[model samples]
Target: MTGNPAPAAAYKGPLPRATPETQPFWDGAKAHKLMLPWCEDCGQAHFYPRALCPHCHSVRLAWRQASGRGKVHTFVINHKAARGFEDKVPYVIAVIELEEGPRMMSNLVMDETPTPENVHVEMPVAVVFDDVTPEVTLPKFRPVR
Candidate 1:
Protein backbone atom coordinates (compact mmCIF):
# COMPACT_ATOMS: atom_id res chain seq x y z
CA MET A 1 0.00 0.00 0.00
CA THR A 2 1.22 3.53 -0.73
CA GLY A 3 0.75 6.71 1.27
CA ASN A 4 0.95 10.31 0.16
CA PRO A 5 4.05 12.27 1.15
CA ALA A 6 4.33 13.49 4.70
CA PRO A 7 4.14 17.27 5.08
CA ALA A 8 7.18 19.59 5.02
CA ALA A 9 7.03 19.62 8.77
CA ALA A 10 7.64 15.93 8.16
CA TYR A 11 9.84 16.52 5.11
CA LYS A 12 11.84 13.31 5.10
CA GLY A 13 9.21 11.63 2.91
CA PRO A 14 9.06 11.83 -0.83
CA LEU A 15 6.91 14.46 -2.49
CA PRO A 16 3.30 13.50 -3.11
CA ARG A 17 2.67 12.07 -6.56
CA ALA A 18 0.78 14.20 -9.09
CA THR A 19 0.57 12.51 -12.45
CA PRO A 20 -0.69 14.19 -15.61
CA GLU A 21 -4.06 12.57 -15.16
CA THR A 22 -4.33 13.55 -11.50
CA GLN A 23 -2.83 17.02 -11.68
CA PRO A 24 -6.20 18.72 -11.29
CA PHE A 25 -6.81 17.02 -7.97
CA TRP A 26 -3.58 18.37 -6.52
CA ASP A 27 -4.11 21.73 -8.17
CA GLY A 28 -7.41 22.09 -6.32
CA ALA A 29 -5.71 21.09 -3.11
CA LYS A 30 -3.27 23.95 -3.55
CA ALA A 31 -6.26 26.26 -3.60
CA HIS A 32 -7.70 24.46 -0.54
CA LYS A 33 -10.54 22.97 -2.52
CA LEU A 34 -11.63 19.35 -2.83
CA MET A 35 -12.19 18.30 -6.40
CA LEU A 36 -12.61 14.84 -7.91
CA PRO A 37 -13.20 13.11 -11.20
CA TRP A 38 -16.78 12.40 -12.10
CA CYS A 39 -17.67 9.65 -14.49
CA GLU A 40 -19.55 11.14 -17.38
CA ASP A 41 -21.00 7.77 -18.32
CA CYS A 42 -22.14 6.51 -14.92
CA GLY A 43 -22.51 10.01 -13.46
CA GLN A 44 -20.68 9.24 -10.22
CA ALA A 45 -17.78 10.70 -8.30
CA HIS A 46 -14.41 8.96 -7.86
CA PHE A 47 -11.00 9.64 -6.43
CA TYR A 48 -7.30 8.94 -7.24
CA PRO A 49 -8.04 10.38 -10.66
CA ARG A 50 -7.72 8.22 -13.72
CA ALA A 51 -7.89 8.85 -17.44
CA LEU A 52 -11.10 6.89 -17.83
CA CYS A 53 -14.13 6.13 -15.74
CA PRO A 54 -13.35 3.17 -13.51
CA HIS A 55 -16.91 1.87 -13.62
CA CYS A 56 -17.75 2.03 -17.32
CA HIS A 57 -14.25 2.53 -18.70
CA SER A 58 -15.49 5.70 -20.39
CA VAL A 59 -12.61 7.75 -21.71
CA ARG A 60 -14.69 10.90 -21.51
CA LEU A 61 -14.65 12.21 -17.97
CA ALA A 62 -15.28 15.43 -16.13
CA TRP A 63 -14.35 16.93 -12.77
CA ARG A 64 -16.75 18.00 -10.05
CA GLN A 65 -16.29 19.83 -6.80
CA ALA A 66 -16.53 17.75 -3.65
CA SER A 67 -18.69 18.51 -0.63
CA GLY A 68 -15.63 18.15 1.62
CA ARG A 69 -17.75 16.41 4.26
CA GLY A 70 -16.88 12.83 5.15
CA LYS A 71 -16.87 10.24 7.87
CA VAL A 72 -13.91 8.29 9.23
CA HIS A 73 -14.17 4.70 8.03
CA THR A 74 -10.94 3.19 9.29
CA PHE A 75 -7.68 4.43 10.75
CA VAL A 76 -4.41 3.87 12.61
CA ILE A 77 -2.34 6.08 14.83
CA ASN A 78 1.39 6.22 14.09
CA HIS A 79 2.89 5.82 17.52
CA LYS A 80 6.21 4.89 15.98
CA ALA A 81 6.95 7.84 13.79
CA ALA A 82 8.48 7.73 10.31
CA ARG A 83 11.80 9.45 9.49
CA GLY A 84 10.62 13.05 9.11
CA PHE A 85 7.67 12.83 11.45
CA GLU A 86 9.61 11.51 14.42
CA ASP A 87 8.60 14.48 16.52
CA LYS A 88 4.88 14.18 15.99
CA VAL A 89 4.24 10.69 17.17
CA PRO A 90 0.80 9.17 17.72
CA TYR A 91 -0.91 10.93 14.85
CA VAL A 92 -4.15 9.70 13.37
CA ILE A 93 -4.23 8.27 9.87
CA ALA A 94 -7.75 7.77 8.56
CA VAL A 95 -9.75 6.30 5.69
CA ILE A 96 -12.56 8.78 5.31
CA GLU A 97 -15.87 8.08 3.58
CA LEU A 98 -16.88 11.05 1.48
CA GLU A 99 -20.59 11.84 1.34
CA GLU A 100 -20.37 11.18 -2.40
CA GLY A 101 -19.36 7.53 -1.71
CA PRO A 102 -15.58 7.65 -2.30
CA ARG A 103 -13.19 6.84 0.49
CA MET A 104 -9.91 8.76 0.92
CA MET A 105 -6.97 8.27 3.24
CA SER A 106 -5.67 11.34 5.04
CA ASN A 107 -4.72 12.71 8.40
CA LEU A 108 -7.06 14.07 11.09
CA VAL A 109 -5.84 17.38 12.40
CA MET A 110 -6.55 20.27 14.90
CA ASP A 111 -6.63 17.82 17.72
CA GLU A 112 -3.93 17.75 20.35
CA THR A 113 -3.14 14.17 19.35
CA PRO A 114 -5.28 11.90 17.16
CA THR A 115 -5.56 8.27 18.13
CA PRO A 116 -7.86 5.38 17.36
CA GLU A 117 -9.33 5.47 20.81
CA ASN A 118 -9.92 9.18 20.54
CA VAL A 119 -10.92 9.27 16.89
CA HIS A 120 -13.87 7.03 16.32
CA VAL A 121 -14.86 5.43 13.09
CA GLU A 122 -17.88 7.11 11.44
CA MET A 123 -16.97 10.47 12.92
CA PRO A 124 -17.78 13.43 10.71
CA VAL A 125 -14.89 15.40 9.28
CA ALA A 126 -14.23 18.30 6.92
CA VAL A 127 -11.39 19.02 4.54
CA VAL A 128 -8.52 21.15 5.79
CA PHE A 129 -5.10 22.00 4.42
CA ASP A 130 -1.64 21.99 5.89
CA ASP A 131 0.69 23.98 3.67
CA VAL A 132 3.34 21.42 4.40
CA THR A 133 5.74 22.74 1.80
CA PRO A 134 5.98 25.82 -0.37
CA GLU A 135 4.89 23.80 -3.38
CA VAL A 136 2.70 21.24 -1.66
CA THR A 137 -0.45 21.52 0.40
CA LEU A 138 -2.00 18.50 2.05
CA PRO A 139 -5.78 18.04 2.17
CA LYS A 140 -6.17 16.68 5.64
CA PHE A 141 -9.38 16.47 7.71
CA ARG A 142 -10.66 17.86 10.95
CA PRO A 143 -13.92 17.59 12.85
CA VAL A 144 -16.53 19.40 10.80
CA ARG A 145 -18.61 22.17 12.29
Candidate 2:
Protein backbone atom coordinates (compact mmCIF):
# COMPACT_ATOMS: atom_id res chain seq x y z
CA MET A 1 0.00 0.00 0.00
CA THR A 2 2.88 2.33 -0.67
CA GLY A 3 0.64 4.62 -2.74
CA ASN A 4 3.00 4.83 -5.73
CA PRO A 5 1.34 1.64 -7.04
CA ALA A 6 4.49 -0.38 -7.76
CA PRO A 7 2.92 -3.45 -6.10
CA ALA A 8 5.95 -4.01 -3.94
CA ALA A 9 5.65 -6.60 -1.22
CA ALA A 10 6.06 -5.68 2.44
CA TYR A 11 8.62 -8.31 3.46
CA LYS A 12 10.76 -8.55 0.33
CA GLY A 13 11.70 -4.88 0.11
CA PRO A 14 14.60 -5.35 -2.32
CA LEU A 15 15.99 -8.61 -3.61
CA PRO A 16 19.44 -9.49 -4.76
CA ARG A 17 20.22 -10.63 -8.29
CA ALA A 18 20.03 -14.27 -9.24
CA THR A 19 22.46 -15.91 -11.64
CA PRO A 20 22.19 -19.10 -13.75
CA GLU A 21 23.56 -21.24 -10.93
CA THR A 22 20.85 -19.88 -8.62
CA GLN A 23 17.99 -20.11 -11.12
CA PRO A 24 17.06 -23.63 -10.07
CA PHE A 25 16.70 -22.54 -6.43
CA TRP A 26 14.41 -19.62 -7.35
CA ASP A 27 12.31 -21.90 -9.56
CA GLY A 28 11.68 -24.25 -6.66
CA ALA A 29 10.57 -21.34 -4.47
CA LYS A 30 7.82 -20.46 -6.94
CA ALA A 31 6.39 -23.91 -6.23
CA HIS A 32 6.56 -23.24 -2.48
CA LYS A 33 9.49 -25.61 -2.27
CA LEU A 34 13.18 -25.40 -1.49
CA MET A 35 15.62 -26.95 -3.93
CA LEU A 36 19.35 -27.22 -3.37
CA PRO A 37 22.19 -28.60 -5.41
CA TRP A 38 23.44 -31.97 -4.21
CA CYS A 39 26.67 -33.64 -5.05
CA GLU A 40 25.62 -37.02 -6.31
CA ASP A 41 29.20 -38.14 -6.49
CA CYS A 42 30.10 -37.19 -2.94
CA GLY A 43 26.76 -37.48 -1.17
CA GLN A 44 26.53 -33.92 0.14
CA ALA A 45 24.44 -30.78 -0.27
CA HIS A 46 25.55 -27.15 -0.47
CA PHE A 47 24.15 -23.65 -0.83
CA TYR A 48 25.03 -20.60 -2.95
CA PRO A 49 25.11 -22.93 -5.92
CA ARG A 50 28.07 -23.11 -8.20
CA ALA A 51 28.73 -25.23 -11.30
CA LEU A 52 31.33 -27.32 -9.48
CA CYS A 53 30.58 -29.13 -6.28
CA PRO A 54 32.30 -27.67 -3.24
CA HIS A 55 33.00 -30.99 -1.53
CA CYS A 56 34.49 -33.18 -4.23
CA HIS A 57 34.90 -30.51 -6.86
CA SER A 58 32.65 -32.59 -9.04
CA VAL A 59 30.80 -31.08 -11.97
CA ARG A 60 28.17 -33.78 -11.70
CA LEU A 61 25.92 -32.07 -9.24
CA ALA A 62 22.15 -32.47 -9.36
CA TRP A 63 19.23 -30.38 -8.15
CA ARG A 64 17.28 -32.07 -5.35
CA GLN A 65 14.16 -30.74 -3.69
CA ALA A 66 14.47 -30.50 0.08
CA SER A 67 11.93 -31.22 2.77
CA GLY A 68 13.07 -27.92 4.32
CA ARG A 69 13.77 -29.30 7.79
CA GLY A 70 16.73 -28.04 9.74
CA LYS A 71 18.27 -26.94 13.04
CA VAL A 72 19.64 -23.54 13.96
CA HIS A 73 23.39 -23.79 14.08
CA THR A 74 24.15 -20.26 15.22
CA PHE A 75 22.62 -16.80 15.00
CA VAL A 76 22.76 -13.13 15.77
CA ILE A 77 19.74 -11.05 16.68
CA ASN A 78 19.96 -7.73 14.88
CA HIS A 79 18.36 -4.83 16.68
CA LYS A 80 19.18 -2.40 13.88
CA ALA A 81 18.39 -3.07 10.25
CA ALA A 82 21.02 -2.96 7.55
CA ARG A 83 20.80 -1.10 4.22
CA GLY A 84 17.49 -1.44 2.31
CA PHE A 85 16.33 -3.99 4.89
CA GLU A 86 15.54 -1.28 7.43
CA ASP A 87 11.94 -2.46 7.43
CA LYS A 88 13.09 -5.54 9.36
CA VAL A 89 14.88 -3.64 12.14
CA PRO A 90 14.78 -6.38 14.73
CA TYR A 91 15.31 -9.93 13.45
CA VAL A 92 17.34 -13.07 13.91
CA ILE A 93 19.75 -14.15 11.21
CA ALA A 94 20.88 -17.74 11.57
CA VAL A 95 22.91 -20.45 10.00
CA ILE A 96 20.76 -23.56 9.79
CA GLU A 97 21.96 -27.08 9.21
CA LEU A 98 19.43 -28.86 7.05
CA GLU A 99 18.55 -32.50 7.55
CA GLU A 100 20.30 -33.29 4.29
CA GLY A 101 23.43 -31.54 5.68
CA PRO A 102 23.56 -28.25 3.84
CA ARG A 103 24.23 -25.17 5.93
CA MET A 104 22.35 -22.06 4.84
CA MET A 105 22.16 -18.56 6.26
CA SER A 106 18.60 -17.22 6.64
CA ASN A 107 16.23 -15.28 8.88
CA LEU A 108 14.40 -16.76 11.88
CA VAL A 109 10.80 -15.76 12.59
CA MET A 110 8.55 -16.31 15.61
CA ASP A 111 5.98 -14.66 17.87
CA GLU A 112 8.52 -12.57 19.80
CA THR A 113 11.81 -11.06 18.76
CA PRO A 114 14.78 -13.33 19.46
CA THR A 115 17.84 -12.86 21.61
CA PRO A 116 21.22 -14.54 21.13
CA GLU A 117 21.01 -16.64 24.29
CA ASN A 118 17.46 -17.63 23.42
CA VAL A 119 18.66 -19.50 20.33
CA HIS A 120 20.61 -22.71 20.53
CA VAL A 121 22.91 -24.76 18.32
CA GLU A 122 20.41 -27.53 17.65
CA MET A 123 17.03 -25.84 17.81
CA PRO A 124 14.63 -27.52 15.36
CA VAL A 125 13.44 -25.33 12.51
CA ALA A 126 11.45 -25.44 9.30
CA VAL A 127 11.47 -23.41 6.11
CA VAL A 128 9.19 -20.47 5.40
CA PHE A 129 9.18 -18.28 2.32
CA ASP A 130 9.10 -14.52 1.83
CA ASP A 131 7.97 -13.78 -1.70
CA VAL A 132 9.89 -10.56 -2.03
CA THR A 133 9.69 -10.20 -5.80
CA PRO A 134 7.23 -11.72 -8.26
CA GLU A 135 9.91 -14.04 -9.57
CA VAL A 136 11.91 -14.55 -6.34
CA THR A 137 11.26 -16.06 -2.94
CA LEU A 138 13.59 -15.67 -0.01
CA PRO A 139 13.83 -18.64 2.35
CA LYS A 140 13.26 -17.96 6.04
CA PHE A 141 12.82 -20.20 9.09
CA ARG A 142 10.52 -20.83 12.03
CA PRO A 143 10.50 -23.19 15.02
CA VAL A 144 9.40 -26.72 14.24
CA ARG A 145 7.34 -29.36 15.97
Candidate 3:
Protein backbone atom coordinates (compact mmCIF):
# COMPACT_ATOMS: atom_id res chain seq x y z
CA MET A 1 0.00 0.00 0.00
CA THR A 2 2.91 2.34 0.54
CA GLY A 3 4.73 1.71 -2.71
CA ASN A 4 3.78 2.70 -6.23
CA PRO A 5 0.55 1.02 -7.24
CA ALA A 6 0.66 -1.64 -9.93
CA PRO A 7 -0.28 0.16 -13.12
CA ALA A 8 -3.96 -0.37 -13.65
CA ALA A 9 -5.38 -1.35 -17.01
CA ALA A 10 -7.51 1.17 -18.83
CA TYR A 11 -10.32 1.81 -16.44
CA LYS A 12 -13.30 -0.32 -17.29
CA GLY A 13 -15.59 1.04 -14.65
CA PRO A 14 -17.66 4.20 -14.96
CA LEU A 15 -15.37 7.10 -15.72
CA PRO A 16 -15.86 10.51 -14.24
CA ARG A 17 -17.86 12.74 -16.49
CA ALA A 18 -16.49 16.14 -15.84
CA THR A 19 -18.74 19.13 -16.22
CA PRO A 20 -17.84 22.81 -16.33
CA GLU A 21 -17.92 22.93 -12.57
CA THR A 22 -15.67 19.90 -12.05
CA GLN A 23 -13.16 20.22 -14.86
CA PRO A 24 -10.47 21.57 -12.59
CA PHE A 25 -10.56 18.57 -10.29
CA TRP A 26 -10.32 16.18 -13.20
CA ASP A 27 -7.51 18.18 -14.73
CA GLY A 28 -5.54 18.07 -11.52
CA ALA A 29 -5.90 14.33 -11.27
CA LYS A 30 -4.68 14.02 -14.84
CA ALA A 31 -1.54 15.78 -13.64
CA HIS A 32 -1.32 13.47 -10.57
CA LYS A 33 -2.41 16.14 -8.16
CA LEU A 34 -5.31 16.24 -5.75
CA MET A 35 -7.39 19.37 -5.99
CA LEU A 36 -10.52 20.35 -4.13
CA PRO A 37 -12.88 23.26 -4.36
CA TRP A 38 -12.28 25.86 -1.70
CA CYS A 39 -14.62 28.63 -0.68
CA GLU A 40 -12.88 31.88 0.01
CA ASP A 41 -15.74 33.40 1.95
CA CYS A 42 -16.21 30.51 4.29
CA GLY A 43 -12.54 29.47 4.34
CA GLN A 44 -13.77 25.94 3.89
CA ALA A 45 -13.29 23.25 1.25
CA HIS A 46 -15.76 20.96 -0.47
CA PHE A 47 -15.88 18.00 -2.83
CA TYR A 48 -18.13 17.15 -5.80
CA PRO A 49 -17.71 20.71 -6.91
CA ARG A 50 -20.77 22.85 -7.29
CA ALA A 51 -21.73 26.35 -8.42
CA LEU A 52 -22.39 27.58 -4.90
CA CYS A 53 -20.29 27.04 -1.80
CA PRO A 54 -21.85 24.59 0.60
CA HIS A 55 -20.37 26.34 3.61
CA CYS A 56 -21.14 30.00 2.99
CA HIS A 57 -23.22 29.76 -0.19
CA SER A 58 -20.65 31.92 -1.98
CA VAL A 59 -19.87 31.82 -5.66
CA ARG A 60 -16.25 32.70 -4.96
CA LEU A 61 -14.96 29.18 -5.07
CA ALA A 62 -11.51 28.15 -6.25
CA TRP A 63 -9.46 25.02 -6.73
CA ARG A 64 -6.74 24.27 -4.21
CA GLN A 65 -4.14 21.53 -3.90
CA ALA A 66 -4.71 19.04 -1.09
CA SER A 67 -2.13 17.59 1.27
CA GLY A 68 -3.36 14.14 0.29
CA ARG A 69 -2.96 12.78 3.78
CA GLY A 70 -5.97 11.51 5.64
CA LYS A 71 -7.45 8.83 7.84
CA VAL A 72 -9.89 6.10 6.86
CA HIS A 73 -13.14 7.28 8.41
CA THR A 74 -15.02 4.16 7.38
CA PHE A 75 -14.99 1.42 4.75
CA VAL A 76 -16.63 -1.68 3.34
CA ILE A 77 -15.38 -4.64 1.37
CA ASN A 78 -17.32 -5.14 -1.83
CA HIS A 79 -17.34 -8.81 -2.77
CA LYS A 80 -19.78 -8.27 -5.60
CA ALA A 81 -17.98 -6.43 -8.33
CA ALA A 82 -20.05 -4.03 -10.38
CA ARG A 83 -19.62 -4.30 -14.15
CA GLY A 84 -16.08 -3.72 -15.43
CA PHE A 85 -14.79 -4.41 -11.95
CA GLU A 86 -15.22 -8.17 -11.95
CA ASP A 87 -11.46 -8.62 -12.15
CA LYS A 88 -11.19 -6.68 -8.95
CA VAL A 89 -13.56 -8.38 -6.58
CA PRO A 90 -13.35 -7.72 -2.86
CA TYR A 91 -12.22 -4.14 -3.22
CA VAL A 92 -12.40 -1.62 -0.44
CA ILE A 93 -14.76 1.28 -0.74
CA ALA A 94 -13.82 3.81 1.86
CA VAL A 95 -14.66 7.24 3.16
CA ILE A 96 -11.42 9.12 3.67
CA GLU A 97 -11.20 12.24 5.80
CA LEU A 98 -8.69 14.48 4.07
CA GLU A 99 -6.31 16.59 6.04
CA GLU A 100 -8.07 19.63 4.63
CA GLY A 101 -11.19 18.32 6.41
CA PRO A 102 -13.35 17.13 3.52
CA ARG A 103 -14.45 13.53 3.36
CA MET A 104 -14.50 11.80 -0.02
CA MET A 105 -15.75 8.42 -1.16
CA SER A 106 -13.02 6.50 -2.99
CA ASN A 107 -11.58 3.06 -3.47
CA LEU A 108 -8.80 2.16 -1.07
CA VAL A 109 -5.92 0.40 -2.81
CA MET A 110 -3.86 -1.67 -0.46
CA ASP A 111 -1.06 -4.20 -0.73
CA GLU A 112 -2.88 -6.60 1.55
CA THR A 113 -6.39 -7.88 1.43
CA PRO A 114 -8.63 -5.47 3.29
CA THR A 115 -10.39 -7.11 6.23
CA PRO A 116 -11.97 -6.09 9.48
CA GLU A 117 -8.78 -7.22 11.17
CA ASN A 118 -6.57 -4.95 9.04
CA VAL A 119 -8.56 -2.00 7.69
CA HIS A 120 -9.51 -0.03 10.75
CA VAL A 121 -11.13 3.33 11.28
CA GLU A 122 -8.73 6.25 11.52
CA MET A 123 -5.99 4.44 9.61
CA PRO A 124 -3.64 6.96 8.00
CA VAL A 125 -3.59 7.03 4.22
CA ALA A 126 -2.23 9.03 1.29
CA VAL A 127 -3.32 9.66 -2.27
CA VAL A 128 -2.33 7.68 -5.34
CA PHE A 129 -3.22 8.33 -8.96
CA ASP A 130 -4.34 5.82 -11.55
CA ASP A 131 -4.39 6.94 -15.15
CA VAL A 132 -7.38 4.86 -16.09
CA THR A 133 -7.64 6.53 -19.46
CA PRO A 134 -5.78 9.07 -21.53
CA GLU A 135 -8.27 11.78 -20.54
CA VAL A 136 -9.04 10.61 -17.03
CA THR A 137 -6.97 9.80 -13.97
CA LEU A 138 -8.57 8.75 -10.73
CA PRO A 139 -7.32 9.61 -7.25
CA LYS A 140 -7.32 6.63 -4.93
CA PHE A 141 -6.01 6.20 -1.41
CA ARG A 142 -3.50 3.81 0.13
CA PRO A 143 -2.04 3.28 3.53
CA VAL A 144 0.82 5.67 4.26
CA ARG A 145 4.15 3.87 4.19
For residues 21-140, could you state the per-residue lDDT of candidate 3 as single tens digits?
A: 999999999998999999989999998789989888999998999999999999999999998898888899999999999999998887787788888889999999877777778899
- Better model by lDDT, 2 or 3? 3
* TM-scores of the candidates in the order shown: 0.88, 0.86, 0.92
- What are the runs in model 2 whose C-alpha is more than 4 Å off? 1-12
**Location of the lowest summed lDDT over 10 successive residues in candidate 2:** 1-10
- Residue pairs clashing in model 1 are none
Name the weakest run of 10 consecutive residues (lDDT summed) in model 1.
Answer: 1-10
For model 1 the TM-score comes to 0.88
User: lDDT tens digits, residues 1-145, model 1?
Assistant: 0144444554664468789998999998888889999987899888779898888888878888898999999888889887767766878889999999888899888446764557888989998876777787778898775
Native-vs-model 2 lDDT? 0.80
Question: How far is each candidate from the true structure, as Cα RMSD in Å?
Answer: 4.6, 4.0, 2.2
Give lDDT per model, in order.
Answer: 0.81, 0.80, 0.87
Query: Which model is ahead, 2 or 3, in terms of TM-score?
Result: 3
Q: In candidate 3, where is summed lDDT lowest over 10 consecutive residues?
A: 1-10
Superposed by TM-score, candidate 3 places the C-alpha of residue 3 at a distance from the truth, in angstroms, of 7.6
